[model samples]
Target: MSKGKTDDVTGTDTTGHSWDGIEELNTPLPRWWLWTLYLCIIWGILYTIAYPAWPMVSGATKGVLGWSTRANVAAEITAHEGKNADLVAQLLATDMDVLPASADLNRYAVARGGAVFRANCSQCHGSGAAGAKGYPNLLDDDWLWGGDMAEIEYTVRHGIRNEQDDDARYSQMPAFGEMLEKDEITAVVEHVVSLSNADFDAQLAETGAVVYADNCAACHGEAGLGDRSQGAPNLADAIWLYGGDREALTETVKNARFGVMPAWGPRLTEADVRAVSAYVHSLGGGE
Candidate 1:
């Protein structure tokens, strides 16, 4: 009854193998299946011959066709970039100052600049530009440097504290310890805190007002409004470059906080730098 059994009616001979009267047949594999297997083997051989398929003592086999994974990847990248070539070129050629203020333009530049900022600046200016201890926040209306487009652009083109660049955006917040007594600085800090609507001893703040006007007014305004050109902070605002604590203010007065905003001119392409400038200016509520 087995498939291997010889036909009893015809008396065809068996394959000379049997088990419990069940005979085995001399069956061969289907020709199509055999040919398919042969084709796969042939493809592997050809592939090995035409590509870097084998490791050698010196190096891998240099296939006859010279095809490389790197080359394939590069080709794909080139194709992808080719599509955006015009947009990138136009952006580069466009003047940053004269850029249109359309939401679309702002959004595009913001998106592009956001990527760049995250890569280069997120460490200092948090992803949202809500700064940490030493760094200044970018989200608010406050600016050590002016918040205007031109001012922002200038800051980006030439960074602060960049010693390498001759024209780096530079400012030195003078150390008042040598100029003013510690008590006087404390009074000024107290006075400055009062200006921002924070609680302060009335007598101390009043006395500090005199110290502020005498020593700090030259850079920080008579009303503690701040001078942007000199990168002086606005003391009247809630935003603080450094913390609003007595200890932090004392430290600032003793050592002076000269925070540096890096120049983007040399590092980034003109388009990218301009886009960043545009994006930063778009943070809103900037005076």
Candidate 2:
């Protein structure tokens, strides 16, 4: 191979390499393209120096300009919170029971509460508050611990059957499988089914009436309307938390269901709890 050679046909300089008698040309890149590439590299270096870049052990390096998207977001949040400070103060000061009397305050609470609900409560109660198998539906009037604004507020503050809060709405249904015979438990389930307008064995339900009277009537009322004081759900209503079917009821009576709700009082501000309470109450289920 030669270091430099001229092609006879085109009179262009060869790159001193050839394959199959075809010589490679020593053609230079266009000056404009070369300059553009150089400028891009410079711009990238400048941008990195002027903004957040270069990952570190703790976090990214604070560039010369100290620009931070997180800082910007925090600043915006602080500004918004400052603007809503007055409304939040009023919300905290006002009693939850009579909150609806002030239309503007109630409106603000509901709107704010909706946002809070979507962020925190949506996982269990669903985005629409329709609830799942174990979670109680918030959109219905069948509340285990009462559906009034005050009650809702109290439940939201203290929570239900949780170990975190001492004042949590607590209730423990005895496992009938351990206490009663299999036949007796089955009869009781039949009675519960009969109460809910579902098909059931009349003979089993008749026998279940006696079992229910002896055991369930203490918490679930004689008419199966439930006792809010004890957080006992109404067996008569079709809206069941665990489920109303025979198999589900059997499982419930045997092992018992212990659903827990976290106390929002410790986690959320007073305004937030009240706001969410108001929001839940306004969902057409409040008494």
Candidate 3:
């Protein structure tokens, strides 16, 4: 039963509803605001008709304009690829070994390779190529294989001891547990440990030296200098893929270490392979 009425105090129309002693005034919205709201409503309707809006079972409605965000993105990608096609072709043609001779190509490869490494190699080798346990640190001075760019490329292409790739770099260290007596294994562990650690038992090392000379010397070298030819690790240098401690050396000598790296050759484009190799070589460890 509320009706509009004029208030005596301000001479403004009252809404005829009051709480306590206060009355509400019938104030209209700004003209500009009302006009804007109407325009928005109209715009929304046109937008629904002109662009993808309503959803269906399989997809959204293709609006009258026949435009798609996905199509736009695909076109953009195609254009980008066209722009870089020549560069990519050049990269592919260039030998990874001599790619660095071209300053511009090297820079481009390194930049591209860094991105590739982050996406693919960073999981095992770390973002900085510092590596984790069981993974060889790419940033280190030592390498199980050669540390140069060409060697890195070969390793990346062929992989290490991977059954999937027949051309993989393959090496075997005999499980001394099967070959050597328990005392001999223990002594060999002591000798290998003494190669790196200063406080090893000299008597045990002397005993292990004979066993080492007989077995480990061929691959690991008499001076324990790792042979890159056989992928044997240098014990005397103290750098270890596993660890250089006595217990670590003991386990390695007894059990043996066989690590596998999946070949990138099959999956990645040649340019990508070279780029990632270049990036790895740029890491402090590379010769």
Candidate 4:
């Protein structure tokens, strides 16, 4: 209260300082607000005592409650495992091939497979399975290996181009140029192009038949249908490893092409591989 002056109209003591002749009031903190602040201070003290609050060289202080981040994480995992107990059991007991064809089960498996694919395959095949330049697209109906469910499962389990995988699918198409003469190679290229409905001189292909029998028939078959065991591709189909163009065919005969697919068995669990195989098979091509 102001010692020198008081407001006669209101009958209240005036504060000492005024701004532009207006008086100011000295207000006390509300009881509720003060209590809240006190409670916050108490909470801080209790929290410090109940949990690890001080940092040390190797670790932190183990407080009275013995709470720790590791303990919290383990607790969370335990809770998750409890909730998924049935799913885990079903996955383990049921054969992957015999899983029900019901929509609900299919949706669940695909979702699970999607997670596995992102974790393991997204590096080569994009998140949407839209493969890179050398890698084959899952969305397409073409597959270097057979696109059967069993085939896909086998490929994922054994892997391709995996050095450590003993049962991995292995094949190597040797360079034909090293064995065949230049004219013979040219004829074979012409014959190969002809199989795709590309224009070619009949005489050239006729001459090339001898070259095909001697050089390519062992792996590619006399009909050019290819052998899955050897990983040789069907030459008659429009699909070409390098390209379907004449130039591509010429280069192919000159030097046999070898494409690599990494094995996933070493990188992912068996369950994960099965899920991934199912997902890939469902990608518009599986029998």
Each model's C-alpha lDDT? 0.79, 0.92, 0.89, 0.77
Q: What are the per-residue Cα lDDT tens digits for candidate 3 across 1-287? A: 36889888788888877878678887778999999999999999999999999999999999999989999999997897688788778888898778778898888888989999999999998998998888999988898889888899999999999988988999998888898898999998899888888988999999999999999899989989989988998888877788877677788888998999999999798889988998898877888
Least well predicted 10-residue stretch by lDDT in candidate 4: 99-108
Best by lDDT: 2
The global Cα lDDT (0 to 1) of model 3 is 0.89
Give the RMSD in angstroms, all C-alphas superposed, for model 1: 8.0
lDDT of 4 at 139: 78
Q: Write candidate 2's Cα lDDT for 179-200 as tens digits.
A: 9999998998999899977577
Q: After superposition, how far is residue 113 of candidate 4 from its true place, in Å?
A: 1.1
Compared with the true structure, the alpha-carbon lDDT of candidate 4 equals 0.77
lDDT per residue as tens, model 4, 86-185: 7656655666566536455555556767888888888888888877655667777666678776788889888776687888888888888898888988
Best by TM-score: 2
Model 3: lowest-lDDT 10 consecutive positions: 1-10
Backbone clash count for every predicted candidate, in the order shown: 3, 0, 0, 0
